[model samples]
Target: MEMTKKIAIIGAGPGGLAAGMLLSQLGYEVNIYEKNDRIGGRTALHKMGKYSFDIGPSALTMTHVLTSLFMDCKRDILDYVSLLPINPIHTLYFQEVTFPLYSDYAATKAVIKTYFPGEEEGFDRFMKENTKKMLYISPLNQFNYSSLFDFFRPTTLRAIPSLTLGRSLMDDLARYFNSKYLRLAFSLQMRYLGMSPWDIPAAYSIVPFSEFYYGTFHPIGGQNKIVEAMQQVVTENKGKFFFNSEVTDFELEGNEIKGARLASGQVIEADYYFTNLDFMYSLGNKPNNHLEKKEYSSSAFMLYLGLSIVLPLSHQSIVFPDNYREFSDNTIHKKILSKDLAIHITNPSATDNTMAPINHSSIRIMVSVPNNTSAIDWDKETKEFRQLILDTVKERLDFPDLDDYIEEEYIITPKDWEEKYHVKYGAVFGLQHLTRQHGFLHPSKKLPKYKNLFVIGAGALSGSSLPFIIENAQITTRKFLQKENPSNQ
Candidate 1:
């Protein structure tokens, strides 16, 4: 009789949870070990009194990814979670004007004509060109490429033009928009990766394009609903979750992971090991201080505020600094916090009443800051920086008595990410998506020497965002099936 395969997953983040669902459905015995008592690492939920906030990922785009995952499992996603579409995806507040990005092509064009007349033509061209770019690149994003030879595949070869070699995101936007503010509006999506528009490659222009093409969504309760839904699927398939059971390190043989060692000194052996821990954190030791050489993405300082009054704001909003480029350079390159801040505020109460009590609001604020590599002392800086963000919001949004309404509050700085969450360098976005880190060049899902070990998370090939990470997990699962059941092929 053939023995059933057992897979051990470390960390119950989105990636691990998704992997558990996929693998369990494939008839594998799956066990997930998480350090925290709750699931959903960074994607976890936080509740204070009657208000709640999604700890990360304020909004959800790319609904099709979740739809496909559920379809593959022979289940309907709606049965587990409710998805509400967000119109006017997000509102952008400039110094002199407010602009809302809509999924409707005609509506977006009308807004462009109203705000900056001549730019309406540019919007049409931008959509047309970027649609082609997304078509060219989408196919290859689903592959699990571990080496440069993988790029030699016909699919990757066909994507070269869409890569837009040697062009930055700012340069690509400039090709269409003559207005600097308009360019800034489109490139605001760069914050999702913790990158500067002048630094990330033009191929990423597909990001903003995708937002307008496929409108964003909000899960009725919070972004964490996706996690809870996936967990339900995993549990229904007989997957087990071990909370507060941390996998401290892996016991290794010549070229395989023998077993995972937990913090309690327990050794759990399995047929395969999948870790969703932060990439660098999984390495156990940096080995010659190699970590000092790699470039990491910037970190975020987040504030979760539960207010006593309803906030008169859209579901999502971005308030740009007076000078975006300077602020980007300071926060991402110079490794310093800029007083001129670009803040993203999400008031989920606008669309989902479940987020807060009646007549109350739950607000989440995120500001980019230097990662843990910077010497800035978050202990000394968090108080003043928090006040600065609140003050800026009060002044810019004309909410004079904003402070008086804060009934409950929580903050996460780069320091808190490292000490509490164990994220390497407190880089919430993982590695920087530089030109050198694209496609085959990014960290491979499987290490060359580790025959039975794999990685799936923000640091892997698909990079950041909940959808990409979950998709990458699916790819990893398929690859695992092919390798272990070659005869079944």
Candidate 2:
């Protein structure tokens, strides 16, 4: 038998835990170092009094990705964590009407045609086209995207129609809808990537396709339970986890990584290192050079409210601005603060019993904003931004007495996320999905100067979604395992 290779993964985010769990099962000695006391980096949970909320990634789309990962480990996923389906996936509140999008193909089309009318054909065409686009591009998402040239491989070019190069997600969706409201519905997936549809690559239309195809989900306890389940898997496989251990820097011998040095002055050696941190944070003092030159994604202003009273609301709702284009341009491109803005509301307690007190609810409000790349003074501005969000939500969403019902409230500005999570430029989703930043144009997953180091997670390969993060971990683990084999070596 070959000797086991010791591995050290920085950050216990979903990516790190997934890799640690899988690789540990393969008989590697895996150790995960997490800066925070809890696991699940960004998707971790928060508790205030009797109310509980998922700090990030409240919605879980493409849950099959997780199902497959757990099953591949020879464990039934449902046994570890329970996932509840999010039907009528999201309710969209436009100026004139409220639209509910369902997961069923027939139901979604019917809703679109009923509201927009004379638009069934385009809706079908979009489903057909983006369905094909999703199938064609999905396998590529798992490819060890080392460089741009690898993206031009013959397998990808055949899926050319799905590329729709040089066009934006908004432009491509325009072909599918005459209704600005309907177009907004389909193109709104761009916001999840922290980019505007007007600038994000048309290839990203896969966001909506994935949502409709696989449907949206929420775990029983909270979305953070997904991370908790992954951590359980790691422990079952004998993987070790070190919490409250912040990695100060890498210990390198020549070009290869020897191990990582912790803030506690402990040095643990490993044969290989995986960074679950965002790409920029992983680089530390290393010259970012081309890495910094890439466009970073936008940030978010968030409010986590623990309500004394449960409101009759869906698991998720989107309130769109009367003019979405102007809103997108202001938040994404111009980086201007919009007093009147689009916001996402998530009420997890509406469905789950474990998230809050009896007859109470937990709500999260998120509004996209320019990342730290701008000159905005978040410390001073966030104080006012909180009031703007509270006022807007109460007015537009008809929660006039929200302030009185609030039992506990937690606000996170972009600066708060940056200072807390070590996110580069406070870009939660990492790189922008522009022509250069999307698809094969995504920056290299491996550091150009480091041979044994790998990057995985939102800021690295597989974009920002939770499923994609798990996929990135799987791909990175397999590649490393393959290289470990004598034949590949």
Clashes counted in candidate 1 amount to: 0
lDDT (10s digit) by residue, model 2, range 48-92: 999898888878888889998998788888998888888778899
TM-score to true structure, per model: 0.97, 0.95
**Candidate 1 deviant stretches above 4 angstroms:** 277-288, 444-448
Question: Pairs clashing in candidate 1?
Answer: none
Evaluate residue 197 in candidate 1 and report its C-alpha lDDT on the 0 to 100 scale. Answer: 93
Each candidate: RMSD: 1.5, 1.9
Residue 10 deviation, candidate 2, in Å?
1.1
Clashing residue pairs in candidate 2 (N, C-alpha, C atoms within 3 angstroms): none
Q: Candidate 1 on 32-83: residue-level lDDT in tens?
A: 9999999999899999999999999987888899888988888899999999
Which candidate has the top score in TM-score?
Answer: 1
* Counted clashes in each candidate structure: 0, 0
Question: Where does candidate 2 stray beyond 4 Å?
Answer: 277-284, 438-441, 486-489
